[model samples]
Target: ILNFKNLEYFNMDFCTAFSNSFLQMSELMASLKYLSLSNSYLNGTILDQGLCELVYLQEVNIDRNNLSGSLPWCLANLTYLRLLDVSFNQLTENISSSPLMNLTYIEELWLSNNHFQISISLEPFFNHSKLKFFDGDIYAEIETSHSSLTPKFQLTSISLFGHGDSGIFPKFLYHQHDLEYVDLSHLNLTREFPNWLLEKNKKLKRLSLVNISLFGPFPLPIHCHKNLRVLDVSNNKLQGHIPIEIGEVLPNLVVLNVATNAFNGSIPSSFGNTWPWGCFYLEYLVLSNNSLQGQLFSKEFNLTKLKRLNLDGNHFIGDIPKTLSNCSALQGLYISDNNISGNIPTRLGNLSFLDAIMMPNNRLEGPIPSAFCQLRHLEILDLSRNNISGSLPSCSSPFNIRRVHLSKNMLQGPLLGDLSYNRLNSNIPDWMNRLPQLRYLILANNGLEGEMPLQLCWLNKLQLVDLSHNNLSGQIPHCLYNISFNYREDNHDLFDQDPQILYQLPQLQILYTNYHNHKYLTNFTTKQRLYTYEVQPLHSMSGLDLSCNKLIGEIPLQIGELSRIHTLNLSHNNLTGESPVTFSHMKQVESLDLSYNNLNGKIPPRLIELNALAVFSVAFNNLSGKTPDRVAQFGTFEEDSYEGNPFLCGQPLLKSCNENGP
Candidate 1:
């Protein structure tokens, strides 16, 4: 293609096989104005003298590659270049002395996620009057410079993420009046909220000053910036009541996240008010982890376009506003860790787009409304730590439901189940067979009784099963081996890796990308201690705990088929017979406990093959003869692992194998 003398544009983005030789040939195309090799796996130092020969080059993009070493100094020769993107690479160079200082005509520069250290002040680009878009990082401390050195350019979008202390705001931004997007997150700027930025930039649309240590009450902009859409001041020390007219001031906001701040007082009623043009355009509103008090909303509350409302970790009182149902487009409602009281409104079922309803650790009461069954898109429903009573509605089933946490409630009777820490008194219900997508079955700490049901075996995707501390009895269900305890590792499409469960709005895409890091969590007893597992660990974990139960009978040999299980606990039961020799096939078993049982006969010497075993115990069993050979993980076991097995002799135990005549 380089042979074509007049080739003005050449694009090979996403062409991973493209070689560095292409860069060497680019100098031949003297008329080339635009060249893009993004994500083309181009590595090594960029050819210093190759592309610089194309004096007519106006744009260059080499982003998302493995290109290392300092940027070519010859880039300064391309005076006509207007846009240059070398982001997401291994480029390491100081921004002050870099060739970018000579790109006086450059309008757009993208240098994010690189090892480029920036100077305390942005004096290098002061002469680049045409620069409008600059997105880079500050990897070193930025000293507060009192010198009144202003730049000639007014950037429309500037994003500078600081890794070290940026003692104050970038003084250059003070003179920028045409600013549209500004993100100076993680800077640790110890100054008060810079309200002057808003007062100056009338065209600003998105401003994210997250974790910058900005204190003092957030002063609202005096003038209504109609173009403003997103305002994220979260993870700061901003205190005092949030300006009540905030909604009226920024009516077109698509996202307003003020979470993890010291803000107090009630939410501005104007947030839910309709403007003369139409309903409020606000879609994602987050006010969690603040000292905010008072009722959630007033009588006129109606934000029709609101999608995700998070009012959790606050002192907010009063019932959840019934008018919340008016948000027909709502998807997630998080009001957990609050003082809110009253029954969940059945009207919430009207939100057809609702997917998550997390209201744990609140003063909610009354039975869960049966109308919730109407929500077909619902994925998460957490109402734990409430006074909700009565039998669970039989029709409580959403086709896409993935997590249900109704624990610590006054609920009774058979459950359609994941209801742990409740007062339910019944046999493991057969209705559970209908939940073919069940991944976690946590019915622990309840009055559940009866034999381990055969229907549980139908849940082929089961990963964790905790029936410990219950009245459950009868032989361990041999059919449980039919369930694939290891589901997540093999099924990539079962659950999305992205924890952001809510739908992404196009407008707030960049501003609200990291709004929440949601993770699936559950508590289970393992290694004689209760532990909470979440996210990646939870997905890779597979365990079964039937300890502290009335279960009696020979250990099911079929259970040895669960070779991928991480934990297996049948301790504190009346189990009999020799430990299964087939357990040697448990290649991934981390914790295995068969203690406090009537199991007899020689210990399975083949069990020594479990290299991943971390917590192993056959203590208090009536087993006799020498223990498994002390090697691999078995060598790490102490005397406690074989304490109560009086007839069992091993290296770890006080008794010798010779004394037991092994």
Candidate 2:
């Protein structure tokens, strides 16, 4: 309160109610040395009459407020000021020429995200011998011509954060040998890789030069023993081979990302050969989108503490070294789009913490080892487009599997009847009915033969059921209408359940790669095109593909209760039915395909309500009717969508809606 005349520290941040009244008291706080009104939503100008008289104030933080108008030039009179943070405010107009330059003791200056006029020179502030941290847009070009005007301060950190024109790399950086953190990413600095910048900074920890115009090969330092933790130079024009001694030299590295570069040559064998088992501090190593070749070293990796390893988008050959199993903490392994051959090491199954293992588009062969059953936390297991054969491994339980991409291989065996693609060849497993999390059950293109098991209806959360291209028979289960996830209820007891229960589901992530510049992942066919879901939206994806099977019976009316289903394909099957009128309830349905089937009925008029329908095909069916009015998505359909039905007439077709031709 203003009553405290000697109060040296005043902080009103997030005090939404303390508005104009607080700004009025600024004139009384002449002795206040530190003041922070950040995010207080305070309005009004900080004019010459305000706290500008507090010339002895050491720090001021009024960031993220509604404050407007030019900060009074008299702020420069605060000769002892050490910190000034006015970022994210409406402070327009430039500060007086010497406002900040005159503060001989100002140490940290933050003027980012403000509307200040771009006519100020940063050169003046550099003269302060105590200034250490400066974050602001340098509008004027930093004059590198002044070799005599050396910076008086030793800056350990500098961040322009890609604001304003990126002037040439700060020349003064050469003199400040204590630099530890630097971020010049997404800037227009057209300089060659600055190898000399690391010469004196023995404690350099983090460095990011991403998306900059730095060119030429990265120079290998004479000695790389600094305690650097992160080095990201991704999306640059850098090239040449990574140094063979890099692993041994940068022993404290935690992240090494050089993706999307033109780097060539083999991954150095020294990476794993020199370090003793579990001696490295690295956790994430990404080298994707390069041309690195040669067999991954068999004895070079002792990565017991490693977590994420991405070597995809390369030409690496030979077996995935069995030594990879030595990384007991490995979670994500992406080796897709490579020439890696031979069996997946059974020892890899020992990594029970693995969450994703995507190795598609490779030359790997042999059956997936049963040892993988131990990876209870695995969510994505993709081995598609490989020479792999034999039935799928009988994982004792697929409790956490979300997406399994094993198509286009030499594999044989019955498709697992549930979301799991196990080696089960019997009636639909009873365990599948008990699974409350079952969503996608893709067993198409296999030797599965049996009745459509009624137990499947118990999967209240089922979304996608792809039993197509198989020998399935019997009637559709009517109980499918009772699916729990499809119905949103208002009676849910929010107070009775712990919110943490929702976190039990494994986190979804993309287990993918780009081959020939196209994303290659587990795909689902719908609307005449193959689709892949991104990780987040994948949670709401719903579809069914029971086409190309020998299924028999009437289409179940209960199917309409699945209001959340998006794509339903029952085409190319032996089903007879009056197009279920209940289908109109499938308001979210995007594609409906009932073609090449035995069905006779008037196309349900209510089906026209499916506004989200993007693809609809009912051709080759024994149906008779004036096709649903040419409206909404129906207007986009072509005659071929209804061609086989000689009795069906519509605008898309030349046939008229009459007794003889319609």
Candidate 3:
């Protein structure tokens, strides 16, 4: 293709093989009017000279490449250039003072996500009268002040996130009337809600004001424009109740998120109200971390196309509505930490598209829904801290269940039986080994009996295993260290979302809850204290907790091999043995509790170098020794952390080390 001098259009986007050889092509394809090499694996500094020779080029997109260095000063020579997109590259240093200003024909310019160190003025950009899309920073200077400025272009889209100081809204926006899309996110703009921008740019289709300092009640206009598709005001300082006419006014809205705000009061029943057209086309509605209370069973919320509805961290009270089954297209429903009561609706299983059902920390009760087993695509099921009774649902079908949390619940008996939910009092079920995709399984504080199942060793993807406070009695399985996700370096495929579920949903967010990268939240019992971890922190965490159980045996030395393990608790058991010096091999362990055991040995001195150790306790043990040297995290421990062992002595403790004792 290099021989063809007539090549006018060259597109190699996402082509990893296309490298610096593209720079030489300019000699042959001088007539090239369009060139897009985005996401290509091109390395080294972007060529400063070659691109200018292609004077006929109208559009050039080389974004998301490894190209670095400052903006090419020669770019201004390409007066015929209509569009230029060099975003998401490693380009560093200051831009040329008058860069691309002479390109009067330029209509679109995207220079975001680069390390342009110097501040730029909007005066030069004013020369490009045809500008329709400008995303780079354009801080106003004395010459470009709004009162005297007269912009020649009418921008349809403007994105200025993390671009400039949080002064008043760019006053130049007052000159433009055709704006359709605007993103002022992550800017400390202390303006009052930017309702004036909404009033002026009525054609705005997408408005994002995330993490801004906007104050005062959200000014939701009574009459919403028909084209307003998305409105994200999350992570702001906004207060006051959400307008009651939100659903009725923003009828065409698709994504409405006001999460992490101070808004209080019950969610208006009008929130569930529909437009005159009968159905709502809304897809993602997130109102988490607000003070919104009251029942969720409003007649207005008949969103059939809804995918993700997150109403967590609120004070909402009332029964989990059975009418929620009407949301036939629902995928991820997170209503945890609310005062909602009532039994798990069996009808929820009918939504074959459902991926997660997180209803933890609620007042809901009754047996686990056996119909939930029918959801072949279910990835997460968290019903912990509730009064949910009965045993786990018995189903022989292969599943995609990765995380199941029934801890702190009233669930009783062994998880064994067929689909009929009949009692089969026995040991841990052998069928648990069949679910190879299982990563986190927590059933702590339940009354499960029988020896720790050896079949659980077959879970190759197991990362977090907790069976604490149970009636189980047996030596811990030694093969537990072989779970692939923890032991293997190439277990990336294990934690990934099921390929079948991904193929079925196709969209990046199946139900608008982006949990593909997020692991299920799990509580860790380290140092005799419970700590809750959400998704982000769970990715790097691996743990094993079998404390407060009746198991009687020596601690498995093989547990030391789990180098990726972050928390390991085996306290309150009747184990008898010397602490494995091999335990020092756990380099990444953050919290380790081996207290309340009949073990007899000196605390491993090698453990002192465990730099990541934040919590370490071995109280109530038969151990006797001078505590490990108090350095780093060791200096922060209290005397109670090493109490109940009268023989052990240290600096923080009242008892001192014996003279000349090793």
Is 2 or 3 the stronger prediction by TM-score?
Answer: 3
lDDT per residue for candidate 2 within 519-600, as digits (tens), equals 3344567896767654234456678888887777899988877787888899998889788998999888888999999998
Which wins on TM-score, candidate 1 or candidate 2?
1
User: What TM-score fits each model?
Assistant: 0.91, 0.80, 0.83
Per-residue error for 385 in candidate 2, Å, reads 2.2
Error of 1 at 641 (Å): 3.7
Predicted structure 2, TM vs. truth? 0.80
lDDT-sorted candidate list, best first: 1, 3, 2
Q: In terms of lDDT, which candidate is stronger, 1 or 3?
A: 1
Stretches of candidate 1 above 4 Å error?
2-5, 144-147, 276-279, 425-437, 451-455, 458-460, 482-484, 489-521, 535-537, 550-552, 630-640, 643-646, 650-662
lDDT of 2: 0.72
User: Per model, how many backbone clashes are there?
Assistant: 0, 2, 3
Task: Rank candidates by TM-score, best first.
Answer: 1, 3, 2
lDDT of candidate 1 over 543-569, digit per residue (tens): 999998999988888989899899999
Report every candidate's CA lDDT. 0.82, 0.72, 0.73
Clashes in model 1: which pairs?
A: none
Which whole-number lDDT from 0 to 100 does residue 545 have in model 1?
Answer: 90
TM-score between candidate 1 and the true structure: 0.91
